[model samples]
Target: MPNAVSLAPAVSAQSVAPAFHEPLHTAHDDDAWWRSSVIYQVYPRSFRDLNGDGQGDLAGITAELHQLADLSIDAIWMSPFYTSPQRDGGYDVADYCDVDPMFGTLDDFDKLTARASELGIKVIVDLVPNHCSSEHPLFKAALTAGPGSDERAMFIFRDGTGPDGSNPPNNWQSHFGGSAWTRTLNDDGTPGQWYLHLFDSSQPDFNWDNPAVHAEFERILRFWLDRNVTGFRVDVAHALVKADGLPDWGGRPDGCSSDGYPGHAAPMFGQKEIHDIYRRWRSVLAEYDGDRILCAEASIDPLSRLVNWVRHDQMHQAFNFAYLHHPWNAAELRGIITDSLQAFDSVNAPTTWVLSNHDVTRHATRLGENNPEVGLDRARAASLAMLALPGGVYLYQGEELGLPDHLDIPDEQRQDPTFIRTGGERVGRDGSRVPLPWRADEPHYGFGSTSGGWLPQPEDWYTLARDVQQTDPDSTLNLYRSALALRKQLRLGAGSLSWAADYMDTDIIAFLNNDVMVIMNMGESDAYVPSGTVIAGSHADAGAEGVLAPNRCVWIKLN
Candidate 1:
């Protein structure tokens, strides 16, 4: 049995409770402020637009910092805004140091950094270390230098005749389907050699084996830290290192393909050597104040093994995707939360939870696309559950308002490279990437009248717009504000957590911390309370509850 953190003695439900506000505690230097804080991810292209270019930019983000501050978010994880050809939705970096002109100038980034800091929110940018655009100067140099040239060694290059002259160097398939290797013909007009790409052929993988690569990335980290950027959300971080020797993956009956090749379970990508690299990054982060965080994007399930990446020496946290993928069920959610807490406790490593992100379907759509109330209720429940956990939490943009996935994208208007590659079987992320609706009546939903959004805005979003919700006392946005205020007021982030006695009940998910008990119902119907007086809930009436209501939550004071 796990040791539990005891709750403070009971208080009356009718007492007008004081708000919870306490300074955040730090576990170590180079650790993320988000460990005990709430972070909201802003996919810049979809967050807001100030310039009317029909795209979101750094300036737009700067303009919207107050919205996040208003919600009491502790930090912001801005997606990649670096120069790119948009081949992989800005994941393919053309320049690491400068902001893409489409997003705005370096001056704009400086302004955003300063404004976010002023608002008390840490800014963490996405760091894509695994690959760069095929148009990158390094790739061009590799092409011009030919095999055996030092530049050619910067990336993986192989020359050989396959079983069939038409086959690739290996059987690996790209994440977007088709062969992972693209044949780049030599300048001599001879048969082209193959280069590896894990995703789009336009985005080639980086070779971490090179000393120059590590040094270059370290310098990049320092550049941002020096500029006051708090930290990084490492993209495909596990792929930084790859297995040597480029061995062919053995065939599997499970239909699993590696890189595009059948049976390629190469240890190269998630190799243990990655730890050494993480340690190196950690050391650099320490040079600053150790307050900087390094969050990894490892999507593997059975989160136990993934937590290893966060055990003090490697990453500060790795986003857990399993719970995000599960269906809404009382038993399932309870098991997941309980098991995850247990796993994190075993290692003494803090955990991080995320329900929606730029890459996944919006939670509102997951709950029930047509029923806004259901979606809003689920959003409230999810937020409450996430905050009550003992570790960190991340909330995607527009999630607080219960934004639903935009299913109205026309076939021709789709922009996601993944959807294009998969022939639309895979829902492109464009639906979730729609511009934020700041005001229901404003032109372009208050994103910008003159500036056209990169992705189309959902017409329905206007109904749930920020400005509209701000006026409604019972709106989801206000609920989020209240939830965040309560989280801070209770000093919940700093308090130790324990599974309460009734925590395992299928209908109720409860946790005790100091004097507070947070209980949530994942069921689609009202849940009966066994004990405890409700202090705050998804209701104005405090003591009248019999069932928790579909997707409702409560923060209770135990007697």
Candidate 2:
């Protein structure tokens, strides 16, 4: 370990128990913190390493709870840290009840949870119910149980087509590429049965049609919830249920052609059965005292269809990813924001906004065209704009420090199954999954007890290390801190958004959220900045007295 440092966030009463009092912002004025909390996501293996193992673990996370507390966040959403074969970054879970050796033991997880509760940070974990590691005991049992046996019924196993069962059972393709079905060999070395995998062959899709499968997941959820896990972020939330008979999607064009719905749909996704599963899962959460939440990573589009996943008692929130996936443009943003807020409103569910996460390119690099200066500007601009709109927001771990994607990651250092499976034609997500820089000048940048990080961080990351950024008041780190403080103070998340149609600058996006003036200058020239007491911003840099510099967003208090 890195010496015996106290893992507690702070020594205050607020950090120890619920007895401590803190000012509650308007929107979050209610006890349902899930509706308005700012959740910080920490991707394991890339977050911090406690054992000098070059991989992040629970102890490392416990050590950093203090830093997260300083950010004024209500909870931390952790990506998968369960037992896995590491095929899909822990998404391919081999066991649901235990912790992976790489992430530390269940005892370490208990200590981390206890420390987090003391720090007043609720913990949420990633739940990959759609698939499990092919090495799971159930899969092993299925492998030995022969065809048409009870052990094999929990997973989708079918006989192949063509003469002598030589071909795959279906025409479906794995989202990662190649055939979705993988044929296993019998004791005599004959091709036995084909099992379905939506992503990688190492992850076998469960047979949701089997009641035993549903019961197994319910037991798993309760196991975590019993350990005081506040909630779950369901991965592939829209894809649990496949269409009847597993039809071929190869002929149809990509997107919402199957159901003729307003949103994108596929035979493999947005199925009606998925909602019923959540409804059942919701009942399971109801058995607990705390208002446990289920957040969906449903990538459904066109707010209307996506809204269904968040209806009344289903998932408490579905990620509004359509907003994140939209191109950085004025009209596109306005429509998405309006539609999202309105659609979720109809269902009485809070809309969850996330700009970056473990799976994609960091928003900074996505907005910037191989230009750091331009990317940081746009990234900061979008942060305030999203935070001011209302409801809950998720912050990817390094995002507050303005960390950009490490686009030039060496090919050999890449470990993502996507990259390996595709033969490097696609770079995979390794660029965005680099270990976070902590101490400015420390070896391993304070990630572990060594100089080399698991994935090499960019050379310039020292400039954006959390330690350096915290000291620089004008840094993006400080900006996020200030904005979050202001957001809680002003009850911004409790408000409504209205367009300032009177502003004539097409390059600028101006709006009001509960009487707060929000202006984002997306143009080359400075746009006229409406007057109000400036609260928080990307920076204080200005052009003229009443104009905002290009690619900056400002929040002004309404008089």
Which regions of candidate 2 fall more than 4 Å away from where they truly are? 1-31, 251-265, 542-544
Model 1 lDDT per residue over 96-196, tens place: 99899889988999999899989998899999988899988888899999878889778877775555445677776676766778888878887667888
Residue 429 of model 2, lDDT score? 89
| lDDT of all predictions | 0.75, 0.81
Candidate 2 worst ten-residue window by lDDT: 14-23
Which digits, one per residue and each the tens of the lDDT, describe model 2 over residues 68-135?
98888989999999999898889999998999999999999999999999998999999998899999
Q: Cα deviation of 455 in candidate 2 (Å)?
A: 1.0
RMSD of 1: 6.0
What TM-score number comes out for model 1?
0.89
The TM-score measured for candidate 2 stands at 0.92
